[model samples]
Target: MTENGVPILQLSGVSKSFGAVQALTKVDFEACAGEVMALVGDNGAGKSTLIKGIAGIYRFDEGEVLFDGQPVHIHSPRDAAQLGIEIVYQDLALADNLDVVANMFLGREVLQRPFRLDEAAMEESALKTLDSLSVTTVRSVRQAVAELSGGQRQAIAVAKAVMWNSRLVILDEPTAALGVAQTRQVLDLVRRLADKGLAVVIISHNLHDIFEVADRITVLRLGQRVNLYKTAETNQQEVVHAITAGKLEHVPGMASL
Candidate 1:
């Protein structure tokens, strides 16, 4: 990745809590450029909490976040976006009534002059981005998002994220609720994102999809990071064990495991 696998995004001893409930505890996580780092865990294992913290949805109660090896404070979603971090949640967030181009530039539309939209520039850029990602399933970029299949919608959401020079993209359950062929399409797009030297963190419960796309797997259990494994060096059984029974000493009712 980025010279000896130095992480573009790194978190050290990160912790977050809500009143009496600890969602994340001293969790160390990193994602390097040119690789897909899959964040996996059983339900309520802090996967969402950890990414939300990184995405600036929730501030970490403790620990430091470093980007490009320099400490930075992320206090809001806008801050995260400025830092080139984009997270596509499972909802995909595309407006069904809008066309692909309109959806891609929903908030940050290019302007031609005083109070005019740069329709040509926006369309050209959108087409270029979709083409660059090898997203060819769409019949036309001008077509309504509601007409596209699940996979095409996911692709548009991802394309919208990366169009703004995003350095790191976090996808939450991208392939979930898709058909077999659609799943394949999204997985291939995930790999292409990493191949373009962008650090990609994918959160998914499907170990099969994780193994197919991720270069490294980070497993969380009971709000604690239990293990990190290189995909080629480990198997699904080991990852499953880590998710279900990995040891955690600090979390309540989990120390015995």
Candidate 2:
């Protein structure tokens, strides 16, 4: 934890290498509850590698990962899930043929008994989760994922993460390929997630959206963390400089730049 307090998630001196290729250098990162932390960088900046490490897809060569001020080891996706960490990639990983409820409970369905699926309970839970996110665009939870719009599909993916009581949700390029209106929808959903007291980390290239929703910005250059900036204290120019030059005009706070 920094001087401020313990964050929901924290990474210190984390590194990952592939053979002779260094995918990431010693990196320090953190995300606190009730805030949107934007991870921004140029292509090949190790953003994917870093989140993969947090998701348990890749183990860091060296570092400490803390969850709620407690050190923990995340060795696989299941491990991350059990620790209340969920990542929503750009593809969403939804089954087109399945309805919202079915997709939400895809692998982790509630069972009525030893041999029965609890359809009613699952549906009720799904509806409640969606309602908590204020997702009302979809006419019905029974609608196929293929029938839902882009923003609605993204919302469903997020609802799935929150439904499982995930403490931290990392979104990778969530607004990519979305139209203006759809982008607005997803951005609002991101804000709601933080408002609901979840630590949210978003990886995106759009500075406009970053400035709009992010409470803090963490800029990564190459494989190293350049700087962290509080959204209220920094501007796009400073962030762009950090992304390209790997330097910060000024460090904002313990929690940000």
Candidate 3:
């Protein structure tokens, strides 16, 4: 927590339900600029519900979403995007038929005139954004998305978020399918996102991947948040205990995820 008294993005007393099923229970969590908050839990941990609420894929039945210290209601994905919230799913959703440039600027295409597509400007900006993240050796902006490796796909997804000027980028299982080298590549990209001052929320199951890149860890048990811990102040065992037992008997300042 910062002495500044507010996180870049905050959810306070947030709750959600599907009829009688309470998917989330009075959850409070926050993400700050220049940091990665890992949301981890076992099966049926309410991680998905919480993420859906945050991403505006599902509206919360209760509580508040504070972006930059102001209360706001995100009614839809469009609303989230307008607020600079970008969610990068594990699938990436890139257009395989298009190249990196085309995929990055999909839907929000630039036009040279009233109706003509601005191919030149789009390619230039895509290259610029990828380059800013130190993503060189892309071969060409025209290379098809289907032709890229797993790591390159992840990089493109992240680069797309960065291109949107997203203040908070939520990543779901970014390194799940990658080999060790590819995993390292995605992790490095995540670090770069934080270093560029974007608040990142990562949903992942791999402990080593979580520990390698996350500055803070948020754990969910059942459908409730059990604990949130600073990575520097806790060990993997403590985190594991919190995930399974829903409590840490010895750790100071350990709140349930």
Candidate 4:
């Protein structure tokens, strides 16, 4: 939470459905500045639906979205971006043919007079951003993204998200497919993002990784928010139980489990 106790992003009574199949039902979620909020759930638990809604890929059927305590409607990806919201999906969305500097400034490149690409300025800004985030594994900003390791690629994706002065960053499965050292590198960077005062929402199924970097955990079960836990106060067992068998009495049309 911020000084006034308002989360950087908040959703109240959010619901979504597809042809009578409820994906999210009156769910609420919030992410505070300078904190890592982990969204954990099993497959079909509505985690993706919630995040996509936040990113404006799917509009909520019902709910009010608040950003910095002010109401806002995000109708498209561009709308979300303009509101300082950035989403780095699991794919990383980087062009393998492009170099680090080119990927960082993709679609938002700087231009000099006569529409010339401001290569020097873009490179300088990219280097500064990466350095500020302590991403030193990248050998050269001029090297093609295809030549980087999994961890290095993930770092670049994250760096791209925050470099645009984004206030809320949502990462989907950031460490999904990586070795131990690479996972550690990505997790450390995730923590550093929160430490730098950005509202971070990380979606991952790995409890170990979530526990390592999250300040709070939001568990979704069967399209409903079943539990909220302070990472320090709850154990992995408890969280797993919540995900698999949390109370679902409030969710209509769901069978008792």
Candidate 5:
């Protein structure tokens, strides 16, 4: 547990390469249960590469991944899922024509004893999951995705990730495109995810949203982890400096890279 309790996910000296390009260089990261870790960086800062490695889309060439304080290998999305990690990409990847219930159980649908698609069970489970997340924006679980607002769709995407008992949920730019009210609703859901004792990682460029929902902030620059900070100990300026310059003057008791 490294003294701070066992982290749900931890990456140590993690590096990934694509042919001749070094996408990540000795990156160290950790996320704990019930805490929101915000990953912030500029364009081409290797944020996406880091997330891909964790998602099992791109294997890290060097380093180790520890889940619940035990070393594990993740080579595919299924492997990550089996470890109780779920990621919601920025695009959301929901089928517009499908209803909220159908989208929630798209690939992992439940079946009854007779091998028939269990519509009642799936709908009930979907509604229950949404309720657990305190997602009440959408009027009904049977509402079509195409008919729901952007915030509602984002909520459903998050709900789907959490529905499978996922311990760690990573959201990529969840509130990038939405009105003020919609953004607020999505941020509220993000906080509720942590409140339910699930580890949450958010990749976003919005400092405002990060300040609003994150408990800790991890900054990446030039394919490397610059610094990690407690949200309360650092302000927007310090975070911005870490993102642009990769370092800042050491705070009183905070770790220095």
Candidate 6:
């Protein structure tokens, strides 16, 4: 937690190395409920590796991860999900053969007794969740995922995560494949997620979306955190500088030019 009473999700001095390649080094970052924190860095800057660590795919060799003041070992993706950590990848991960409801409850089927799928109960719950989210454009949860627009598909992904009672939803380049309108829709969904008190960690290269939805920005450069600041405290230029030059700010301590 911060000095204030607000709770926080934190990673302290986290490091990961593959063979001789050091992908991440002593990374410290935090995310709070009701806030969207954007993670920005160039390709191969270790952003993916760090996030994968948090996602429970790669166990870090150093540092600790805490959720709401408790250190937790997320050894697998299932562990992450059970802890309310959900990831919405850039690919969206919707099976084209499956309908909306089936996709939403893919591995986690609502079942009775001997693992029999409870179709009626699942459908009712899925519809209720969608309706509450104002997703009216969907004809039916029975429609194939391949038949939905990019925005609709993205909506299904977010709804599924939210329905799973996720406290932290990590979106990886959510709007990358979306057009202007679709991007707008997805950004709106992200805002709604945070507004509903979910800690959102967005990994995106698009500054516009970052500025639109993020309350805090953490810039990573060359496998290290350069700076973390509130959105109102910095601009695109400074973020670019920190990300490229590996400097958080243009300090005045430099020798006379």
Model 3 poorest 10 in a row by lDDT: 248-257
Expressed as tens digits, the lDDT of each residue in 45-134 for candidate 6 is 788998899899999988889998899998999999999999998899989999999999999998977868998989999998898777
* Candidate models: Cα lDDT each: 0.93, 0.89, 0.86, 0.93, 0.89, 0.85
**Residue lDDT tens for model 3, 46-116:** 89888888888999887899999999999899999999999899899998989999999999999999999
Candidate 1 off by > 4 Å:
1-3, 253-257
- The local lDDT score (0 to 100) that residue 195 gets in candidate 5 is 82
- Better model by lDDT, 1 or 3? 1
Runs in model 3 lying further than 4 Å from the true structure? 1-6, 248-257
Query: What is the per-residue lDDT of model 5 for residues 2-117, given as tens digits with 9 covering 90 to 100?
Result: 23434899999887766666667788999899899999999877899998889898899889999999999999999999999999999999999999999999998898876789
- Candidate 6 Cα deviation (angstroms), residue 116: 3.2
TM of each candidate vs. truth: 0.96, 0.94, 0.93, 0.96, 0.93, 0.92
* Cα lDDT, model 4, residue 184: 99
Per-residue lDDT of 179 in model 5: 88
Model 2 / residue 109 / CA error / Å: 0.5
lDDT measured at residue 14 in model 3 versus the true structure, 0 to 100: 80
Give the worst 10-residue stretch by lDDT in candidate 1. Answer: 248-257
- Give lDDT tens digits, candidate 4, residues 1-257: 33333499999999888876888888999999999999999899999999999998999988899999999999999999999999999999999999999999999999987789999999999999999999999999999999999999999999999999999999999999889999999999998998888999999999999999998999999999999999999999999999999998475544223
RMSD of each: 2.3, 4.9, 4.2, 2.4, 4.8, 4.9
Pairing residues by index, what is the TM-score of model 4? Answer: 0.96
